[model samples]
Target: MSQANPDRPDLDLSSCDKEPIRFPGSIQPHGFLLALSPTLQVLQASDNLDDMIGADAARAIGQSLQAVIGEQAGLQLVPEIDAADIGQRPLYLCTLGIGPARHFDVLAHYYDALLILEFESVARASAADFRHLHRQVGDFLLKLTDTASTRTMSALAAQEIRRVTGFGRVMVYQFDDEGHGHVLAECRADDYPSYLGQRFPASDIPRQARELYMLNRIRLIQDADYTPARLVPALNPVTGKPNDLSFAALRSVSPIHLQYMRNMGTLASMSVSLMVKGKLWGLISCHHATPCTVAFDKRTACEQLGQILSMCIESREDANELQFRLDVRRIMVSMLAGLTQSADFIDNLSSVFPALLKFARAGGAAILFEERLLTYGDTPDEEAIRELVAWLDLHCHGDVFHTDQLAALYPPAAALAANSAGLLAMPVSRIHKHYLLWFRPEVVRTVEWAGNPHDKDGAPPAAQLTPRTSFATWRETITGTSAPWHGGEIELAIEFRSALLGIALERAEQMAELAEELGRANKELEAFSYSVSHDLRAPLRHIVGFSDLLLEPSANENLEKRQRFLRNIKDSARLAGKLVDDLLSFSQMGRAALRPTLIQMDDLVRSCIDKLALDIGARQVEWDIGTLPAMRADPTFVQLALYNLLSNAVKFTSQKERAVITIRASDEGAEWVMSIADNGAGFHMDYVHKLFGVFQRLHRMEDFQGTGIGLANVRRIIERHGGRVWAKGAPGNGATFYFSIPKELNI
Candidate 1:
């Protein structure tokens, strides 16, 4: 048994075991520990020196190591001790003693201002049979190298480890993002209980233990029931602290962990850390039902197997990532083609959003273009999504933002964790702040822990250092998290973002070119209208003047012929002048800039009606006007549109004894719709399409005179305001003209 230090009486087993065990001032009963000065004089030895080497612990101190273990035995360890370097691996000395009970394998190292030597008993005769063991290990490695998959390699490793180490059970364990481990593969004897699908919590191996695993790839616990051996001084005499036994093969196991092993009915245990790219990935754990010791050479071989397995895992993952990238590129190409072909880029995203969800394997996705939000698949309500977008806008820094546990990063998202526990968002347009967001739902999982993780009794101020003394299966329901995004998935997301941004840039350039072309066309139209106004009007004016001159009483030879000739000149000149004026009006409408303001539609309609009162003089007109919504638009353009529509209604209904005109507006979600109905000499439905074309009059001049550009002007004005217009009419029936304007516009 280990002797306790007088100054450290408060160091209970529970607390000591939970803390770092690398510098424990003790050794297992199956081994002996000694600290010597540089001159080979014993500075300290285990309290059980007599039991181990037949030398009194107190008397061995301050004596030459040769005096305590005899000349021949001491000479064998002297060279190893002298050659040891601090922080280097411990050197192995030859085995000593004669019988099973007394035979010992010695190891020596220089550490922390002292020479440290450890001695453990040789457990079995087969340990030295390296010739046979090497062949077995070599064959196993050949089998491992043949496999490319991590799972296949792990299975092969577990089976071979159990066969070589003579352990009842061997398990290949892998860690998750949370540091908990799950059994990936297992090989077990028929009598042994299977832990193939079990999970071990992070606390099962504390932080310090994990760090040690990284430094020391292999660890062995010969027997969990063995008593501990205390160092003679309880601390290194040179350093006045516990010896740093981080690399010692015979280091005493933590009492709490030993107890835990006992509870699990494991007599001996060995672990080889699987390291990949300098990081601890998992472990190859071997447990025996009886006391067993793995030879140093065998342990080294196992470590080699772990390294090889790590390489295989890395290689396989790299290949998978390559394939995934190729698939993502293909999907991106298809999506870009669809987007480019679409007339409106943002509207096309609706179809593309579904493809994105499939590619990412996400449950939901959302696209935010300015204030417009479109969602697909399973998603939160619009308001909730908007709030999430606002949060993202505030916190996101780079072009892409991703989180597997969104609730942990943002507190407000905790409530939304069930639907949006993971999010991968990309801002496609920094100027517009448009976002493409993908979501993953929370995964409620049942974690199988070795025991209850919490302290069931009561709260303790000091941290619980002891491993629980139970091996019962504990079920835990983990919430507010999703499956972690892998490195490959994040890479794909970044690549996808880059590709989408490239497409958006291309689209922007095309739009710029189109706008430039439209600008040039407008300029040419203005110049043409100016020329037509001056050049075309002169010929008509001259014709009317010459005809008027000829119609004079002195110039006329026949009265009937003169009257007809003068009338023809006046009619032809009037028609030509009206056409020019209409063409000029159409050109001006195209070049006019819009100045939008909120105006009451009711007032605007009334104003238009008042202006047309002169044309309606002495006409019996009945009006029905409903409440009209206030709209944001160019008031001048809106008034012109209303005037043209109302005037058409008044002119078409001239034959009616009581003309009926109805004006009203209705809200249509993103826009407002206004309509004017009239009872008049309406055109046939077949000719309705021609009614809005310039100079395409339906009725004869004798019946109703019009330039026919009135409706065309109304169409152009409404369209410039980002609106749509349509009409429906039949011969001798009333016509209803409808137009809608967007509720908001950039202008």
Candidate 2:
């Protein structure tokens, strides 16, 4: 930071004027990335430094990279770096095992240090990895478990998955409360499939398939047709009779499934199941163009990685939920502190939802047994979501539940075949009872909702659903429609719902209280106005009445002197009455609401002219009105503002034989700039401040018939419309009254 100095000129040296250092090499090994200033002071460090700088890398990051890496290594590496080598240019690269703990590859580059770090772990004691995936599963669990804003978390999780798997595409698939599935993120690949923003049908992956996914956690069928299928006995663990193996990892291969994958032109596929409390939540799927296989060891590693990634995603989501609750609390506190009324709060409650969340996208919401069609950001959807509680009042009637249960109520119910294809109705558990139900139009493909794979030899006969009829059906089948209740989208609604629920309710309460306050204030103002009308008029009447009384006596020899005195008294009384009226008008201006109406300038000018016709006719004044555009404004106020200017022009130019007043209007994009110029006795420029002041006049009362409030009223009216007014003139030059009115209100 540059220190402030009174002696030195404030010269900023922050411009992009310096060339940066670059490195030169091929096949760069990742290393401790660092950014340095011209003086070689460390400015930034890569996140991979922990693998290089030992355990103290975080603490020592601020130190010079050259000093930390040692002199010999720095000198050898220095000559390799040049300006030409920037983002991708690399230096000394080597993969070395540090101790017996882990293996890492280091790459020194001019732009930054790149380091590739890999960790190895056993497959069976994979609790840590499972925990990580559990976190992700937990994240999915949280999606179903709690109402929270997971936008931030979902984005982060998507990014994390993309980073970890090195897969071209990775997406979060979610099952709607209705058991429909949809894709959340496409995480594009090289020539990434245009599946993004596309929908898929629920029947693409049958109930048997989804249940198997939940139990397996990961399904790595490198080539759907080539991978050996696991066959298990149909005998149930608890019963001696044959039972379904849909949820079993050892199910016989369905030939139709293989054919379907081949038809889709997908050579390989891998997916990590995301489940909540043993129920299938969704899946993280990765696709490959060429036929490939994951070795058992590699498959296990990838699964563990998936698990870790999932857990991190879930943890991050939980953190975000906490933050959202905090934010809602903060906003509510601010509103409560101000003592606002509940109704007023409700009127403006929608504004509280952050702009990032497209609350209007939510189609309908349910609370308990009541379902309500929603209009963006209305009362919290919790009440509406609660209405559906009656349906989930009990668990599945049979011990075995599957997608078959949903067939009776939901569309393409076969899509939920994971458990039994609708076998598991939404449970009436505590989580469901306390949660909100958000329904949207599913707009993307789901985990198991594979598109028409173009071939039929490898597909399973039972896996096929009836062919779609319309393009919309094809579109939905390809993308996977889940009643639009996507995991991320619904997660977002939950987040916003939870955060804004309390604040919105509290604001409503505050708004109601504020309304009462406003009513009381209005009543008080009316009382004050009544008293002023009575009290002020009493004295005014006395002055005028007494002056008239004195005028009645005209017989005395000194009658002329008496008459002059009476005239002076009468004149003073009239001035007072006019001032009182002007004061009342100014006070009323504050209470008026803006009622913008289309006002033709020509009409407004003519109206002012008609009002001043008697005076103009008596004085023999000439007027010039130019072409004007139509504008929106308070017609009455605009007319009054114009009238004062034109009348002033007439008064000031009374000495001229041909007193000319010109009214002209010009459009200025967003406003109308109107000018009234006159050949008048313009005053000194230095005294312009008194022009629009109440009771402040430039001329004596004998020469001008002004209460000094006319210009004041004009200025106020123009300002109320977010416009400005000013006068331009010299002592001898004529004056121009210029004011502007906005085309649109700032609000």
Candidate 3:
């Protein structure tokens, strides 16, 4: 671990992850670092060249690669770089000969616009038998095919790698998704300390170090206290930055890590990264009690074993999950099928128990549907769950949220972790705060750490990161954790949630349509009641007034007046009958189908005005009628719509000195768009949306008498003809009502 910024060097755990470990600007003393330009000229070299290869590193700068190391090394590097995956995986070039007795194995790779060459002394080169390594890996691969379980395979792997490398202790360390490492399996010498069942903190191998292990595949530290060879130029000349030693086999490690190694009583170590599905799964960590080195050929054998182990782990886990996957799929299908066949999903709550919990592999399940909490199986109390739902509304609203250790993410859950340590939440609806959740019970297990992971040393704050001096096993009993949720379980949960959401959405659509129909029925009922009382008022008043006049005692000889009263009574009765017909028509428009025919709009507008003038009497009015066209429509409904508009125009503008009503029609695209304008006491535009809503009136009945169903009826009539209606208005500026009928509609 490199130190954080000294100015603000607070020892936070994340300091390790943020350390820049790749470009340490140095290499271990076991090898030489020679940074070269893209054209093969040496740009920088390690100062240890004098001791390592008996050459002056200063003279190597600005010099061709052949003149610096030797002609043989240069001849082998060009084709190797071109043929290899340079930036990611380092390529091995042919060895170089400095003398008859002295040979160096060279590796070449490129990054940051610079090509680099690392030369390591070929110590005991002939002893690195490739044939022996081949036999070791071959024997394992043959047995690997027969391996059945991950634990069994891990055990075999630990034994095989320890045999190949001759390390005192070899542990198959597996990392959890949270970055904690657990020694799953191990093989060790008689005198070696056993760490088979122990755990290690994630900070022991920071995120960057773990990433480097992923890229390199194999990394070795020959001696814990080996001196690092410093680059002569410190920085690369071409890039003007610290040389990127990400792919270097001899890259220097952090000093804090070296100290950690010494504390563990390990002088040498080699780590082979275990990658599964392109992610770092764990490591084949080898530790030696004495300073030791494993040759390149043997390290390659170990790396290959790690790869094979990763594949076996994936295959074995898949095999284990196959039955569980099938069961979950079956239960999900049965539940959804039942839900779709039922009128209400809540009626199928019986499945939330053993079946639903087993589907998610949880101890309990719940649904926050329709603002109610429904629980089954073992779960937290209603108070705790309601609190969780509130928190989820802010954090995981309208999405899928899950956690194996619920208390870790939501601290308040600590009180409830015993019964609900894990939670899987899926939002059922974005429109409502509805969700589906699953819970897992606390497993109540003990963990053994190599040392106390949370113990802080008595040293000062600055020394907080100092390596622990103890490797003694420390037992800890976990309280708030449950059985881990597998990726397959989470994925299956998502699919089930999606299928259930489809049902939820379908139900919502049906409910919306039903609600709309109910709303229209209620409004029409209100308008019908208002129309009966209102429309009959004038007619009833006329009948009563004329009869009173006809009953005058001295009017026996006045035959003309008596006849007039009788005619008036007859007219009022006819009007009352017409009002009843209008009420019935308006009430049935919602279900009534269109009966369309050719209609002359210009003639229709004139007829509507002539009828409206009967009620208007001698009021001053002006009508500006534009060229109204002929179109195919329901003549009766269209005439009714026209009558309502003409009547409204005359009534609302009754306050005006000279009421101006304008009617216009024009061809608009594939529809005949018409507008009726009025200079009346117009309403505010903000309430315009309510104008066409049933029984929604903007003015008082005392000012302008109406049943408040006129605009709504107009909308229904126009829409029945496959047309649309809209209005725009501002206070005192008057209004313009427009309606359009599709020109191509045969209805």
Identify the candidate with maximal TM-score.
Answer: 1
lDDT of 2 by residue, 364-429 (tens): 322331133223422223332333334433322211122223435544433422222212122211
Relative to the true structure, candidate 2 reaches a TM of 0.29
Model 1 C-alpha lDDT per residue in residues 1-747, reported as the tens digit of each score? 133333235555444424547866677777787778878899988888888778899999999989988887777667755664545466666566633357677767766787777777776532244466567657866886533577778899998888778899999998877788888899999998777777887778877888999988888998988777777887777777777778888777666678768878898999999886678889999998789987666776777777777777766664565467568657766876777667676787887887888777789999898678899988778898888877887667465788888988888788888789998888765334578888999999887766666752243635455445666677889899877776656755665665565455445445645664577555544645554454446557866676777657864555446545655554655555455445545545765578899999999888778867879999999999999999999887788789889999999999999999999889899999999999998778887777776556789867998766788788889989889899888788889999999988855
Which candidate ranks first by lDDT, i.e. highest? 3
List the lowest-lDDT window of 10 residues for candidate 3: 2-11
Q: Which pairs, if any, clash in model 3? A: none
Our tally of clashes for model 1 stands at 0
TM-score of each: 0.64, 0.29, 0.62
Q: Please give the distance, in angstroms, between residue 354's alpha carbon in candidate 3 and its true position after superposition.
A: 2.8
lDDT of 3 by residue, 131-217 (tens): 776788779887776446777788889999999889999999889877889999999999999998899988689878988988888
Off by over 4 Å in 1: 1-8, 12-18, 79-87, 98-101, 123-129, 145-148, 405-419, 455-465, 513-747
Task: Between candidates 1 and 2, name the one with more favorable TM-score.
Answer: 1
